[model samples]
Target: MPQSNTPVRDRLEEILARLDARRDRERAYVKLYTESARAEADAADRRRQGGATLGPLDGKVVSIKDLFDVAGEPTLAGSIIRRNAPPATKDALVVKRLRDAGAVILGKTHMTEFAFTAVGLNPHYPVPGNATDENLIPGGSSSGAGVSAVEDTCDIAIGSDTGGSIRIPAALNGIVGFKPTASRIPLDGAFPLSPSLDSVGPLARTVTDCMLADAVMAGDPMASVVARPIAGLRIGVPQGRLLNDLAPEIAKAFADSLDRLARAGARIIDCRIDDLMERLWGATRIGSIAGLEASRIHADWLSDDAALADERVKGPLRRRLAVPDEAVAALLETRRALAVEMDERLSPYDLLALPTTPIAAVPIASVETDANEYDRVEGLLLRNCQVANQFDLTAITLPMPGQTRPAGLMLMGRNGADRMVMEAALSLEALLRNS
Candidate 1:
């Protein structure tokens, strides 16, 4: 198993000390469970010292996204009006699973309001700076979870992905994030963004950490990821709109990574999926499936306290509130059709590979100050990875090799193939790291 070698108590203290530093406020933790976390760490350490049987996640420090229920506290889902919402009666399902596996729960991290935005700007809380560059935006809406994973605040960060929230931030922050098929991990205690599109997953510095948390959360019993051989692996590279408007750094790193894979004996095939994407996008023209679903989730709130939330979140969602019921029905039908088509389209290949984001993280000020920039960056950030959510596929994002600026190479597979994607990522991650 790939559990951390450091003592759990020491690791917890190190993270707590770092979080306590005033300058780290931009690191974006919304709340800290210091007392309970310390108790858990002590328990884990005692278990370790006693030569107890340990799960893969035993003694690992894990952070929860603010949207998950933690018992006795209302899940904010990055919204303000929920301050007085009734507290949850129990931990979220995934939270309970992680604890059962002996993970040390850290605390909840910040997020975009209602998990709506791609750029990690939460006007309601402290925004997390990019892990590598303070000036760059940490991708969202799993903003703080992403930061916690890369910044070593936690060994694993539990987050939700709807329309690329997990992969976008993982790519920008240069960590590994896995989005299992939406149904793989139960979502009962998570605050909904778009229930149809939402999947809870993990972000961490290594694919192993993500794989461990994923299995635990899904009630799977796997202890380690066996790296699949790169030789003869069929890797499909989708060509067209998903690859459009790439920043030079992203483009070069992607090209370089492909060269490495090809040289390592993987078969690289150029696949065309632009028409499929256009159809998917065309179907949701009234409002994105996420936007439409979110409209319904926030229906009551929009009628009463919409003005209290960030305009970026409430404005777009409010527009979707009036979408005719028929349009929503049609959209769901189209989503099912697209998922079937995508499943067939991906059948021939073991996996699909692409740059996770068209561009690297941009200056926080640029997106924060300009609505135009925010719109453009949000669309681009969500462009490639949203295909996975729309089609119900599984995916993982690993940092591209040898880049001064971080970029991610995302690998995606058909629905219900979460473990297949992880096995491939195990080998691919090794290949990328060596390069």
Candidate 2:
């Protein structure tokens, strides 16, 4: 809902200045495209001054997660092992699209090594602490993406969501994060985490920015997305363990949001897909869709004793590499069936709603000191949002209204229902803000 009239060059300089002033900027960005960014910003400024702006994204300050390729640079993907890897021959497809649309690239932000972890800790890089609090976890593997999305230096931070990489950080940082249908945005040239689950999305302070970035990256014709009317809107709240173990604040915030929507004449129905979810989980018991595919993607390194690689990433992937080939086949077959069933179940509603994370950001010290504590925290954070990735649905996370610490209210739609999900989120964002 907020707009800035500052020139793109000025904005870029201010961000660059702030980076120069701060010693901890490595926590947010692994690289900064200083010269090229300035050039682009100046061009954007010239266009604005001449009334020939490219489109909504023109002149917008944007940041990409480290997994994406820039011409002639190896995408480190938040790990040191790749420093010796050959530089990319060309820009990643999404990067090319963003650049073509006139977005000023601010360089690559930090992420979990290989985007394997969900709670933001990467032994390989400096922690990009939570935006609101220094001690709390920033949420991973798009940890920097989350922090950058909230920081004024970046207007939109692009991140990949295999299993909540985008939404988790966005929720923790209290920004809007959109994860579209898996095939909605092309993934060429981006480092692979899980080919089956990987998706590219944008995190911003407003739904409109997310919609705009998504459109450009998706190569859809530029168009405006109006907020759908809440009156008679059908929102389905999944009734099950997804709503369990609410941090008192998260529970109250979710309940209050549902109440507000109901008061606004939106019909909130209790939707059940517990069986479908359980079956999906059961099938993946051989291995998760991500870990299994990632093992193959990183097979070359899995055999090496690379000390710099985060075991958190390599360890699980190593284990998944051992899963029987037949099991992998069965998992994929079952997943396809369940995805179709889940779609039918959710067809009656405009969107499926729930808390993005079961808990808000937790103390980094606690998670870092204890292995058990880290696993517990990561599971809870990834639990709610992973459903969308696993079940072939698209989702968005909006900052929960009136929360002391940041949290998110997620609305998921049937797979390929990206526009519907964005529209509902736009309307819901307004309702929550006004209330």
Put down candidate 2 lDDT per residue, 1-435, tens digits, no spaces.
Answer: 224478888888888998889855468988999999999999998988888978999989999999999999888998898998999999999999999999999989989999999999999777889999978999998999899879776999999998899999999999999999999999999999988899999999999999999999999985777887888989999999999998999999999999999998989999898899899888888789999998988888888885568877888998999998888988988998999899889879988889999999998999987989999999999999999999888999999878889999999999899997898889889999998
How do the residues 134-187 of candidate 1 rate in per-residue lDDT, one tens digit apiece?
Answer: 789999999999888888888899999999999999999999999999999999
- 300, model 1: CA deviation in Å? 0.8
Best by lDDT: 2
Query: Which pairs clash in model 2?
Result: none
Q: Which candidate should be chosen as best, given TM-score against the real structure? A: 2
Over 4 Å off in model 1, which ranges?
1-5, 23-26
- State the local distance difference test value for candidate 1: 0.89
Against the unseen true structure, what C-alpha lDDT does each candidate score?
0.89, 0.91
Q: Model 1: what TM-score? A: 0.97
Where does model 2 exceed 4 Å of error?
1-4
lDDT of 2 at 296: 87
- Candidate 1: residue 251 Cα off by (Å): 0.9
